[model samples]
Target: MLALSAWAAASSRAWAQAPMEPHERDLYEAARREGQVTWYSAQYSADTSEAIGRAFTERYPGVRCSVVRSTSQVAFQRLSQDQRAGVAQCDVFASSNGGHYIQLKRQNRLTQFRPVNADGMLPMLRTADPDNYFQYSSLGIYLLGHNTNMVSDAEAPKSWADVLDPKWKDKLAVGHPGFSGAIGIWALQMRSMFGPDFLRRFERNKPQVGRSSIDPVTMMTAGERAVGVAVPSASTLFAASRGNPLKLIYPTEGVVAVPAPSAIMSNAPNPNAAKLFMEFNTGPALSRITRTMFSESLRPDVPPPEGCRPLDQVTLLSPSLEDADRGVPELREQWRDIFGV
Candidate 1:
C-alpha cells in the first residue's frame, strides 16, 4: 500500500509537469504574473465547480481560480451588472445557455479566443461557435429523476409528458426557467415537442419549482419530492453514488443534452489567466475531474462517466443556436407568467 501510494504521487507530479504546447506555455507564464482568474460559472454544482477550480490551480501552480457559482440566469445577471458598473471582475464566463453566448457575441462582450485544447473536444462540440467567441466547456443531459425510496422504478416517469399526469400533482420538483438557463432551454424544447400550452398544463400539477437545475435533485434526495422534472443527469447520478435514493429516467421524448459554453470576457481583469482557464476547461484535467462526477466528458479520449450512457448511445434533443437564442427569453417570460415566481 505504501509503495502504491508513492507511485500514485509520482504519477501525479509527472502529469502536472508534462510538456505544454507553445501557446499554453506562453499563456501560463503570463497567467502566473496575473496570479488569479475569476470565473462566473453556472455549468455545474458549486462543489463541482470548486473542485475544477482546485484542479486547475494544481495543474498550474502559480495561478489561482476564483469560482462564483450560481444558476445560469443569476450568473449572467451578475455579469451584466458588472458590465453596467464598468467593473471587470469576471475573467471567464461559463453559462448553460447557448443563447447567452449569442447575445454576448452580438454585443461584443466576449473576447474572440480559440483554445488549443478546443480541438481535442468531440467534433460536434468543437463546432458550437464557429466565430470562436465561446467554446463548449461542459455537457449534461436533462431528464426525469426520482427518489428510489419514494418511487418505484415501474412507477417512475418514463416520458417528458408523464410528469403532467394528475397522479404526480404535488409530488414533482422542477427547475424554474426564469432562474436556470438549462431549464430555459428545457422549457423551450418541451414547448417545441409538446405545444405552446405545455407550461400551463404543467403548472396545474402543483409541482415544487426550484431556482437551479440541481435543486430538484436535492428535493428528491431529501424525500421531499418523489420525482424531478428536467433535472441534470450528472448531479443525479453523483447523488445516487453517494447513497442518495436517486435514479435517472431518460424520458421517451428523448433526453435534452445541454452544452455549456465558457468564454473570456472582453474586459477580463486577468486576460491571460482567463485564456489559460479556457484551455484548462477543455483539457484532460477538467475531463478527468468531471467524469468521476458523472458528467459527460468533452474529450474523445476520456470514457463516459461510470453511470452515464455515452452521448452516441442516447437519443439527444438539443436546441439549435438560433432556436435557443430566440426561444429561451420567450420561455423565461412564459415561465414567469405560468409559475408566477
Candidate 2:
C-alpha cells in the first residue's frame, strides 16, 4: 500500500509539472493548420523582432510568424486603425506601454488565454490583467548611454543632472514621449523626480529627438550624438557587442525599467497560433535570445547579460500603472511645448 501511494504521489507531481494539457495539444494542431501568426510589436527593433519571429517559426514547423515592428505609439495606432476599420490583421500585440492593454481590455479588444508557461515565470513578469488578457514579455532599462570613443570614462555623466549640462548641447540624443513608450515612462519618472521646470531647462540644450528608444544608439554609433538620456541598456549592450562603442550608464538617481506586455487580439484571425506564440515567449526556449539582446529575462532562473547588473541589483524608478496612464498624456503635451517636436 505504501509503495502504491508513493508512486501515485510521484505521478501527481509529474502531472503538475507538465507544460501543457490535451486541450493545448488541440490548440497546437489547430495552429499548425492555420500556418501563420501576425504579430504587431514595439518591444524591440525590426531586427530583434524578426529574430523572435524566425525563432517562433523554427519552433513550430509550418507556422510562420509575421512581425510588424514600430514604435509603441505607432504600433498601437496601427492596431487601433485596423480594429476601427473592422479588419483586424494583428493576431498578437506587444507594446512597452502596459496602459494600451488596459484600455484594450476595457473595450473588449483583447482575448483571454493564459499561457501555460506563466506558471514558471517570475512574479514580477506576471502583471497581466486579472482575466489574463496580456502578459509582460520583455524588459529594458531606460537611462543614460554614451559613445565610449567620444566620451572618455572621466567625461561620462553619472546622474540625471549631469545630462542637463550645457556641454552636451546639440550633442545629446533622446526619444520623444509622443512616440516611444519607453520615453513616455521615462518622462513620467523624470517629472515625478524633478519639477516641470526641469524639462524646459533641459530643452535649452537642444537635444536631438527621435521616435524610437533604439535611435539614440544609432545616433551615437553614427557620431551624431555623444550622449543619450533615453537609450535602453539592452540596445547599448547589443551595440557594444557588435563593436559600436556604446555604453550604458545607470544613473545615480535610478534606472527606469520598461516592461513590454504582449496580448492576443479579440478579433484575431488565427487564435490558436497567437496562443502558441504567447507560449513560446513565456516558455524556456526564448530566454537565451532575450539574454543575447541583454534584456532582463522574465524567468528568474535566467541571469542577465554579462556586464549588465541584474534588475534587483539596479536602482530602478518605475511608475504605477495609474500614474503612467494618467501622466503620459500631460507629459507628452508638455514635452512638445518645451521641445517643439
| Candidate that scores best on TM-score | 1
lDDT per residue, candidate 2, 86-151, as tens digits?
Answer: 897999999888778778888998898888887788787775667788887887788898998899
Index of the highest-lDDT prediction: 1
Rate residue 124 of model 1 by lDDT.
80
How much is the lDDT of residue 305 in candidate 2? 64
| Model 1, span 187-223: residue lDDT tens | 8998999999989999999999998999999999999
TM-score of 2: 0.91
Model 1 residue 280 CA deviation in Å:
0.6
What global local distance difference test value does model 1 have?
A: 0.88
* lDDT computed for candidate 2: 0.81
Clashes of 1: 0
Candidate 1 residue 282 Cα shift, in angstroms, is 1.1
TM, every model: 0.95, 0.91
